[model samples]
Structure formats: structure tokens, C-alpha cells
Target: MKPEAKNETQEMHRVEMTIGTILRWGVIVAAAIMIVGLLFYLVDGSLGVASNYHVQNFHQLLQGLIAGKPYAIMMVGIFALILTPVLRVVVSIYSFYREHDRLYVIITSLVLLILLTSFVLGIEFQL
Candidate 1:
């Protein structure tokens, strides 16, 4: 009933709420990553066997990964696209740990990475 006690309770409640929010978003992100992985698997299957099978442009945006085509290089370069965001998240996680903050790090990193990646990759490289 004391003012100090009420403040403590409010602070604990806020921390709990923030933790719950982070957990929810983490789960959603994990699910999305899983779905995308599954799609990649399906696309891989459509690539077919290596010895005699062929994958046509009907299913491929570029000739094929091994064809050493420019589009293939570009497509492979897309993997590098993840570097900035991954680095940002790593830095933000350390920042959060040092600051004793919650997973706002993830949100902040995502936003920072998106803006940076858009400017660097989308505009500069046209990727």
C-alpha cells in the first residue's frame, strides 16, 4: 500500500509485459523463418537431380546456380545481404546486455538494418 511498494509492483509489471512481448515476437519470427526454410527446400527439390536432370527457366529466375551466370552471382550475393542485419542484431544484443534492457534490441536492430540495407543494397547496388 506504500508508494514505494506500488512503484516496485508497477516496474515489475512493466518488465513482465515487455518480456512477454519479446517472446511473442521471437516466436513469430521463428515461425516465419521456418516457413521460408520450407519454401527454400521446395525450390531446391524443383532443381532436381544433378547427373541427368535439368531445371528450366520455367522454374528458375536465372539459368541455374552452377551455371555461373550473372543472375546467379546476384542471387548468391543476396546471401551477403543478410550480413548488415545480422551484424546490427549482434551489436544491439551486446548493447542491450550492457544496458540491462529487454529485447527492444531486436526491434531497434531490425529497423536500423532495414534502413541501412535499403540505402546500401537497394539504392547503391540495385540489389
Candidate 2:
């Protein structure tokens, strides 16, 4: 193996490590956010009422977040957890494209498309 090929391999490994670190930190941050929200809810004495499982609209959720609503913060944390995998897929798409891996780029693009389609449908159907 040539030194150039070894360097390329190292670069790919670094990219993979970076993506892995991003996912790990994403989950950690999301969990911390959720924990804080839970603590806030408990401290605020909102646990007595039954919490609805309805998904809040993004705009409303953002407003609630600005208003310091615990539930809204929790929902935002959930969204971050959900987005981690989508972010991974996007990163993979870019990596494959840079490597000129046509097949992988197409496959990863399809995965991304499906993920986005599901999110849109979920919002539209309120599911």
C-alpha cells in the first residue's frame, strides 16, 4: 500500500470518528435536556395532571420553549434524538459523494428521502 492510500484511509477513519462523536454527543445532550425538563416539571408541580402525548407543532413548540415550558423543552429534546440518525444519513451522503461512490450516494440519498418523507407525512397526518 502506498503512503497516499494510507493517508486516505486515515482521513476516512477520522471522518467516521467525527460522525460517531457527533452522534454520541447528540444523544448525551438530548438526554440531559430531557432530564432537565423532567426536573423542571416535577419542581413546577405539573406532574399531577395527565400529560398529553400529542406532538406539538414546531412553531408552537418553539414559542413554548421561549416561554420556559418544561414539556416543550422535553419535546425539543425528543426531536434532537430523532434528528441524530437523519444527520448521520446526511453526513454519509456527503462523504459518499465526495468519494465519488455513485451507488452509495444513490442509496444514502434514498434513505434520506425516505426519512424526510416520513417526517413530512407524520406532520401532515399529525401522527
Candidate 3:
């Protein structure tokens, strides 16, 4: 094996190690975001109902929420639902940047756009 070939192998190994570290940390960040958000709900007080107007109930909020995946706690669930995806995004972006992956960045962005469009569109269709 040529000296230059050995050098290349070492470089590849280093790159792989870096990528693995980034991925592991990314998963950790996402999980932490979810867990922290959930804890907030458990420790916080409940959202007080201003007044229960039997004649004028806002089922829209309930319908929109129920149509989607049920959250564990209303506040924490909402935060966790939003935060986890966002944390994943931060992780993906961070990993892509660390790996210097232009193509992956483009693909991630496209997928996010599609997912967001679908989520928004879903709400509209629910009504």
C-alpha cells in the first residue's frame, strides 16, 4: 500500500467517526427536547377555561387537535409535537453542515417543505 493510500484511508476513518458522533448527538438533542417539553406540562398548572359557554363552544380547537395525533398533555404535547420536529431539523442541519453535504441539505429542505404543506393542508381539510 502506498503512503498516500494509507493517508486516504485514515482521512476516511476520521470522517466516518465525525459523522457517527454527529448522528448520536443529534438523536440526543431531539430526545432531550421532547422530554423537557413534556416535563413542562406535567409540572405546570392547567389551562383555565375562561368560562364554559355551552351555547358557544369552540369545537374547532378540539376538532383540529383530535383529528391529529393525540398529545399526552395539552400544553406539553403541543410543545413536544412542535419541538421534536424542530429539534430533528436542527440535528439534520447540523449533521449536514458537519458532513458538508449539499445534496442532503437540498433533499432535507424539500422533504420539510412537503411535510409542512401537508400538515397545514390537513388542518384545512379537517374543517
Candidate 4:
């Protein structure tokens, strides 16, 4: 292979590895947060009553988090989990842009746009 092509291949490999690492760490961190929250709930003996609990919005989530609410912590973990793939899409867009792959960059950007749009509409409609 030409040296230029080989270097480009290696760069792509590195980007893939970075993306993999991001996904791995994102899941691991989210799971850890959720586990900690679960443990707190178990210790507090609030598991039974948790069903009726609701966090109305981000502001409430923040307040609950500040007050050390286990459910709020769990919600944050859930948010992180949901965002992992969105992050991957964002990274893919950047990677494609770096490689001058306009088609892929556009495709990935559209995927990201769809993801964000769905998230917004889901929240707006409370779905």
C-alpha cells in the first residue's frame, strides 16, 4: 500500500478505537452511577415507595441531585446511557469531516439531527 493510504488507514483505526473507548466508558460510568443509586435506595428502604416518585423536569432533577436523591441519580445515569449513542453519532460526524468524506459527514449529521429532534419531540409530547 502507498504510505499515504497506510497512514490514512491507521488514522481511521485510531478514530474507531477512540469511539469504542467512549462507548465503553460511557456505559461503565452510567452503570456505576445507577448501581450506586440503587444501593442507596435499597439502604434507605425506599424501593417500595419509589414507584410514585416523579422528577418533573431538569430543574427538579438538579434539585433532587443536590439533595442526594437516589432516583435522581438514577435518572442522570439513564440520561448518560441515552446520550452515549448520540455522542457516537456526533463523533462520527467529526471523524468523517476530518477525512473529507462529505457524504458520510452529511449522513451522520442528519442522524444526529434526527436523534436530537426525536429527543425534543419526545420530551415536548411527554412520550
Show pairs that collide, candidate 3: none
* Per-residue alpha-carbon lDDT of candidate 1 for residues 1-127, written as tens digits (9 for 90 to 100): 9998897678666655665555555555655544554465466554233555433332353544455433334343444444434544565555565455667776776677776777566544532
Comparing 2 and 3 on lDDT, the stronger one: 2
Each model's number of backbone clashes?
0, 0, 0, 0
Give the candidate order by descending lDDT.
Answer: 4, 2, 3, 1
Cα lDDT of model 4 by residue, 4-115, tens digit? 9999999999999989999999999899999988998888777323676776678988988887788888999999999998899998999999999999999999999999
Error of 3 at 91 (Å): 12
TM-score (C-alpha) between model 3 and the true structure: 0.40
Residue 125, model 4, lDDT: 81
Clashing residue pairs, candidate 4? Answer: none
Tens digit per residue, CA lDDT, model 2, 1-127 = 9998998799799879978987998999899989988998988977323466564488877877887778888988999999988889998988888788999999999999999999999898884
Which candidate do you rate higher for TM-score, 3 or 4?
A: 4
lDDT values for all models:
0.53, 0.85, 0.54, 0.88
